[model samples]
Target: MEQWLGSLIKSGKRVVAPVKHDDIVDFAVISSPAQVADDYVQTRLSAKQYVFPKAEVLFSYKKDGKDVTIDDVNTDEFPETVLWKLHPCDVAGLEPLGAIFNWDYKDSLYNARRAKTTLVTFACAASDEYCFCASVGGGPGNTDGSDVQVTMLPDGDALVELISDKGKALLTDDIKGETSSADGIDKEKFIAKVEKKFTVDEIIKKLEGSFSSPIWQEQSDRCLGCGACAYVCPTCACFDIQEDSHLHGGRRVRSWDSCGFSLFTLHTGGYNPRTTQSARWRQRVLHKFSYMPERLHVTGCTGCGRCSRACPVDMNLVEHLTEIASHE
Candidate 1:
């Protein structure tokens, strides 16, 4: 693994992997295997930022008298990036996240970045209470959006599955061992057991008639409207475009936004559509379970449980969704 990573770095491909920083695990650029976190169950943040930046300049404009000059961002300069050691759930999230950007009008900027990024996912050998990937059409071994899937065996060797041409392209002669038949290897035995709490279909169906349910209020009463959930969520693609102006020039920037924010739905006329936390909370759940599934034919969540982990108020998504699914 170290040699392969070193080779990629030497080849000028930017490799971002999970790294442990002061006991917190998050994705960071690494040049060596020693910088990669080996004991982490999940990264504190997703690798989505490699493709979709938190804030990016779309274009710049300069004012000269009555004429304005516009310069658009060049997508050609985007680096070829490799996201390594990502979990299956995190990799699965790329599907819905990609769908959001490419569903209607194609986002050239997003597509360009996404095209240059390759995913290397590691199957989960252990899980915690917050993980619910199985309930959302994902599993510890799910490789929905993985270019390369690596499953570690009990004997310290790994079973590497090249799922795409890009994945196969990453292999070097040293890393490409002789292909062996896995006639009796049961991958399930090596992965974590994540119980299915509620299915996506059931959640979608229940959410269809749950718009005015009191559960939103019940669940959001303690919500601080911090937007931590959306920020940490791998599939949340909501963004706000703003223009930063100076004396002679300005740039259009797109920054991440969240439905959980209190002012997210505020109108220019001082009228807010979602005035309460319950409404904001309801939008967050329904948008993922009901709206995206109905519109894009994809579940917006991979059940990574990052939102729950990042929430200061301790809002457990699986618990809330399971409760909603049980609703009449």
Candidate 2:
């Protein structure tokens, strides 16, 4: 089946899958299924904006001083994109993005492109010290938001499970593989052995109780407020609105932003709502572990653990959550 799938994808049909680059794996246009990099434990880039880019132009505008004209950008230009070999958290992160992009204002630039893309995810058979998807309800080898889920058999063969029609289309007779029900697999056993060690409910509940906890200040003391954690996080969805202009015309653009920045909540009066790193860190934790749940039915974390890995001061989510969860 693997060989057949590779042949189908290689037929110049515009398929993209994860491929290894340097120390991390990233999704790219694959000429064949053999180019897919399921062996990589994690990806450097969160699978967030392959569908909704980090920055996009909503529309362009022109003004005759008294008259301002707004021209909505054409949505028909978005191309179909495919993503494969995603971890559990990266897959689930898309849902939270849907909440905000679809809130009061519908972002056509994002939703239009997202609609044209299909996501194919693979369960993580093994994870490093930084992974903790299991604690967030997505364990190693877990499939939450994927259209198709893949598993590597003990004999190094691959199993394909189509969770959605979009996923089934990725298959071809040339790939010659068997189908199985992934539903009954022993997910807990897989997580217990290799996935990160953490508890999702406990962290969420602890966050709910730690709104004013002094630990936020202490835990965030070493934070440089660089926003790297937010940038690398799979579920961080804050964005800033801006207008780009030339001499005669301009357009409104939205780019990914982070709450970790000192000026994220700044006002014109020079008052910053979250000036300190602790306050910013507190906001980050509360937003993902608490506030997001209130707004969306799902937790905002997919638990890829990149933030924990990327922190300059070594701010570990597992350590922070463990301490916070133990406060009770």
Candidate 3:
């Protein structure tokens, strides 16, 4: 499918995938095969931007008189975009985000983009000290949110496993002939490795018990509250709604916000719910580990370790979970 993907992009079709730039791989629009790099450790940004862009103009507005006309963003002409070689962690993060977006009021912009894009996740073999996807129900070959999953086996043969209709449609009748057993994927070994490092059931219990612990404040003392961690996190989906104006009139804009920001929980009446980095950090953990799971029936963390990787202070999320989970 990689070669086929290259053909589509080269042929001027919209095939957005991961490409290396400035020594870091990021998902971008590609026009050739030479542009892609599958071995990139972790992208500086998450795959969420394809669906929810960093700085998207929700709509444009103009006012001629007391009667103002609002023009809704034209998403009716979106193109078919294919995301290739995404990690399981980045892919799985999209699940919980869907709930919040579709709740109360529907976000047509985000939903429209998602509907047009097909996710093709590439399995990862390399593990880092900060990575704990195994603990979060992810592995080297997890196929959760992936429509098409490409697994590179030790024998130098690639395994193309299709999970959804979009994945099924990508295969030509000729390449469809290569049907090998998935038994060699080693599901048991992948699962066992995660279980040895962490216990999901016990960790959930510990997370439930420590909501008001003083450790939260002590651990977060050095945090700068720059919002970098949450901004880079695929699972962090907090957003801000505002009005972008040009004197005559304005349009309402919704942009990505972070819980790490001091202004995040600030009320319009001038009361700040979470006033410090310690409080903000606590909210981040609770939202991912408790509140989201309670409402969404799934934890918000993918354990991709991007937060740890991108943190200016080098605050490790894996270490945080392990410390609390192992505490007596």
Best by TM-score: 1
Ranking of candidates on TM-score, top first: 1, 3, 2
Error of 3 at 191 (Å): 12
Query: Tens-digit lDDT track for model 1 on 1-328?
Result: 6777778877889999999999799999988878988876888888888878999999999999899999999999999999989999988888888899999889989999999998999999888999999999899998777899988898876788899999999887776674577767888888899999888889988988788889999999999999788998999999999989998999999999999888888899999989999999999998999899989999989889999999998999998999998988
lDDT of 1: 0.89
| Structure candidate 1, residue pairs in collision | none
* Selected candidate, larger lDDT, 1 vs 2: 1
Count of steric clashes across candidates, in order: 0, 9, 0
User: Measured by TM-score, how close is model 1 to the native structure?
Assistant: 0.97
Task: Judging by TM-score, tell me the better candidate of 2 and 3.
Answer: 3
Order the candidate numbers by lDDT, best to worst: 1, 3, 2
lDDT tens readout by residue for model 3, 1-328: 5556655565454787788887888889887767778666678789898888876888888888787888888897777788877888888889877877886688899899988888887777666677788887777677887889876766766777789998787665555565657775654333213333675566678878787788788788878888788888887888888888987778888888998888888898999978878888888888888887788777888888889998889778887778878876
Candidate 3 residue pairs in clash (backbone atoms < 3 Å): none
- Candidate 3 achieves a global lDDT of 0.78
Best by lDDT: 1
Q: What ranges in model 3 sit over 4 Å off?
A: 10-13, 154-156, 172-196
The window of 10 residues in a row where model 1 has the poorest summed lDDT is 174-183
lDDT of each: 0.89, 0.74, 0.78
Give the lowest summed-lDDT range of ten residues in model 2.
187-196
